[model samples]
Target chain A: MATPRPSGSGKRPTITEVARRAGVSTGTVSRHLNGGHWVSPDSAKAIARAIRETGYVANSTARRLRTGRSGTVAFVIDEPPASFFEDPTFESLVIEVGQALAARDQSMVLLLAGDEDSAKRAENFLLTSGVDGAVTASAQPQHHLFERIQAAGIPLVNVGSPAGLEDRVAFVAADDREGARMMARHLLERGARRLAVIAGPAHTPGGSLRPEAFADAVRDAGRTGGAGGTGAADGPEGADGSVAEGAAARIVTVRHGDYSERSGEDCAAEILAEHPDVEAIFAANDRMARGAIAALRAAGRAVPEDVLVGGFDDSAGAVAEDPPLTTVRQDFRRIAVELVDALGKQIDGGVRANVVVPVQLVVRDSTSPARP
Target chain B: MATPRPSGSGKRPTITEVARRAGVSTGTVSRHLNGGHWVSPDSAKAIARAIRETGYVANSTARRLRTGRSGTVAFVIDEPPASFFEDPTFESLVIEVGQALAARDQSMVLLLAGDEDSAKRAENFLLTSGVDGAVTASAQPQHHLFERIQAAGIPLVNVGSPAGLEDRVAFVAADDREGARMMARHLLERGARRLAVIAGPAHTPGGSLRPEAFADAVRDAGRTGGAGGTGAADGPEGADGSVAEGAAARIVTVRHGDYSERSGEDCAAEILAEHPDVEAIFAANDRMARGAIAALRAAGRAVPEDVLVGGFDDSAGAVAEDPPLTTVRQDFRRIAVELVDALGKQIDGGVRANVVVPVQLVVRDSTSPARP
Candidate 1:
């Protein structure tokens, strides 16, 4: 009778090869890699070395193909790294995006295009990873990868508006500026006199628009001032040095952050230091709003008591905070619903364009009549 | 020369067929699906119906694989339904897990197994989806699908103990009981005389082990009964309705929650109400600890002042809470590290088993000296 075939002999140098090279049993090689099994660190290191030299691919690809799935998607977000996971608003978006992807039998892969290096890595990963399509969220106009993504001609869906990308990429995004304007109008009606705005980074995509929209609403209401009162003239040497002044008091102060929660806290602290009598602080997103509340409390200023705080993005955590936040609610779920629907189209060979969702204001405990 | 291809004579049905059936313009159908293009709400509904009837598959599989990747890995977690996204600890773990998988040239496909139905769906998705491997974080044993995972022999790795699944699966877990015991010892040394333990659900795999470990440590320390008191065989069903003899005074009270922050608050409130002089509370996880702190403060109790508080799982958002948490630190990063390493091994056809990492106590503002 033929001798019992040794395991993995005719095939490639499997675990047995690594075991032999490390001068240990196959079980030892397995345990060393697993970490829970009682194996000496020395033995683990030897096995790792052997495996590296043997050049054995993990071979998950063969199994993956049996299910007929490419197994991944490109989740591209045009934002700073610090702000990616730090902002509750963005975090909620991520959760929703992830959930939507899961529902469609797809995986939502997060790609941070904060800087050039990360962007390059993200683009390379997207192109090579065998993702069916790309989901671009809040991309800036300056993102060089936009062109590359378009050129690759793979199905691409944009989550938010990228400056010039509306012409080429299909996308789904909330009407951000419209939401900001609505918030501004609410604050005005609530009699917010000394308004201070905490905006996101102006150089980035959404940053320039929110403040601009707020200014537009203020102007349309005949309240005087542009999106922000002072432009390039106010503090050209200050953080946002270039401010051309219009109506300064109605739009009293504008401070900028990279849209990170930590930055929100710092910005609030700075704004409070500069304008102690400020009554209403309108943060661009829920994360910044939460930070502002924390700062206000630390400074002994009560929320909606000494000051009425309003934010944008009705993140789930905002409702559970010490005081539930009052802010403009962007329908992220709806946006996601539309986004996936659009992605299905692009991959089905549809032309690229932008899809916009409406935004609304959600009132809660964080804002109130300026304490009589 | 070959006749020029007719403008609309493509192999696949043009956007026109989808639009014609749906009674909408080709542009509307195209925009509704490609993501970025704008479409009227009414048209969107029609297009969805048409696409469904057409049996349209995006064919992302073929197009994406052209670049040589399916780009996905399955992310598996065992959490309760409502607590899935509500619990920051679990949420952060998933994000980190996603990050790790992404780092390894893969994308994470999220699979939530919070209940029986969800678990079945997750198991189906795991098998059917072509994922590279599964990062199973289910803490509930006796899950029928665990056996399925074992039989299928995919690169399955559990984040918690694989209780009855030792032989068939591999896993990466933090030392839960060890961490609990260490915290118990710390509390005892700090002179937390009237101590109480607010544990997680008894049915949960982690919950059962933690309380047992705490009991062991208390016994080892010789701090079971009050210095001169006999074990209580006569109190009204102890605060949590769990029988407690007077002899178990030093480690007296015990209650349980489904492991929610809200439950933490409730447990603290009930225990304090029953035993007003109780000096310390040990919550099973950080979320519960946070709730307890909120409840304590609301009832005029100062954390670590009138009472000391500690928790398990140094989760995200814990350090950032009002008074930073003092708790047992279960290293999720290390867990992720071991998990990826183990998965890489299994994918290489190496038979690996369970791995355990050490747990340590993390001191924060929540715990302090008992009142003088």
Candidate 2:
């Protein structure tokens, strides 16, 4: 089917023609087309019909010149193309954020700064593109895009905790530390003594906080003599040694992945080869957990029988896995909503608000005690 | 870590401060910041360092008023949020398109018109946002966004063949019909007699053309009497009753899906229950094909031993499946590049150019004869 074009003289129709055809004042037609909020249903229908009849197209350039607000916001990603697609959290964030912005009559422009050059270009674009604000998800620590957005003076909100820029920008993030604590404790409850973790990249907030919290939980379990009691020890020492906890003896072995499935598989293999008696594996995200499962199968171990596996981010992959993954669910949708809300507030001249959404642990077959 | 703020007195930095720190003329600094195409490396570095030091932020509102172009484009999606994330094709398209636009120094605004209200809001946003152009991927037939975009007269391009609006806009799509023909012939060559197809939604161009081409291949094979010949008489009537092919006699039975994995699984199950003798199943895309494999496994039918399964769009799922999927490879990156190139042309006052990229069949373990 072809687009029904304006007939006869091959000239485009005008607003005047549309107004005349609709039998309404030009102001009514204009307002109806602009938003139609105040326009009555009869007039809106008439205006819409007239628009179809006359083939009149609104000139956005003139409207933008008059309004000074473009109704556009940029959703920036600091990762490469492959990573963007492979990560389900990014997908969910983008979808929910786009929908939230749409409900507010704003469009989300996606910007990818996968490399230094792209970041430079994105910085320039954000500075000059006339976007009302910007929202970012899963930004790596020290990513240049954060500084660029700040330098552009755009109202910005990072979906996750902006590692180093938390004080400067508005941000909404899931409680990664709390979620990890829950997962680690659950794994210990399932008769796991020697625990291993496939941690995310150290440069990311989720990566750093999740594993740190899990390590603390393991140390706490060790202090409690493998029971669920609160230990007298504070926690495990921070990976950097800058922050100290009571315990010095290590109970959890941690391996890092870049939040990719392949990385999870490789790390899991390395951990298994090095710590053959490890009873539980907690991957920082669902994708890595899936990889860990595959590696476990290859190594002739049955999940929840020989070893228990737990993961963070109850993504679609968690549900789809053979023995569905036991995972911590980060409410990405809520985070998206909060990001938009924070960005919108800042755009409206409100002070930046930092938000941390709650998370929950979902038990599944991968960690079920019934599995022999 | 906090963003390093401008120290002392709390006065915001100005362009003059940046110029003074860089030891360059204001005009030179401005030119370097705008595009830096002709600026020397030393001057550019000095200007960047000076801007960083002074904490100088560009006034985007003032700059937008001076320049008519907003340097923004909308990447529109007509599907729901769940489908948007579930389909790897959409993920690839959005990422690639965003990167392509970024390469041209343009930011991509994502607009999701999942429902009627959202679509209307998206139309209004597109009509008033001052975006230079728009690009959409996988637009279904009768999607209202297409007409709204055309009526707005903004330079627009659809990433796939948009049914019913073919002549009105620019588009770049992978060759779906030829790809389907290749899959069908491959299946027949593998000693398949009875074949069933899990088709995509009929309202989509891919949904319509893929099955038609496969049927044509089946009829052609029948004419050669290769154990499953139903011979050429006249082909089944096309959806529009237009393009005539070979024969109406049944060689391939089809079930439809909305291009989702669950739908593929459900449709495959139904086909197996109804046609127990079916030797091969061709799913329209890899996600559905993965579902088909899962269903086949549940039914105790081993892949390539009991039945062969082929799919389209060799997505990540194709490689990750237990028995990796044999599917058609559509170069999504190329399509994205072409989309940006097309939109760029239209923005540059060039007429619409329709492009069709070639597709290839990727053979994997799913179609290998090892199961029996």
Best by TM-score: 2
Tens digit of per-residue lDDT, candidate 1, span A225-284: 333333412221111122223223366788887666677789899989999877678888
Model 1 Cα lDDT, one tens digit per residue, B32-93: 43331365545645664554344222322222222223345556666643456566666666
True contacts kept of each: 0.01, 0.24
lDDT tens readout by residue for model 2, B1-372: 112234234454556777888898888766655655566657766776676565443333223333435567888888777777777888778878877877777667676667755666666666544466888766654546776676555678887777666787689889988999998877765556578888888767557788889888877877665422333222332212233243322355788888878888999899889987677898888888888988888898888777789999888655576888899999988999998898877876657899999999998877767522
**What would you estimate as the lDDT of candidate 1?**
0.63
Interface RMSD of each: 13.8, 7.4
The number of the candidate with the highest lDDT is 2
Model 2 DockQ, alpha carbons vs. true complex = 0.20
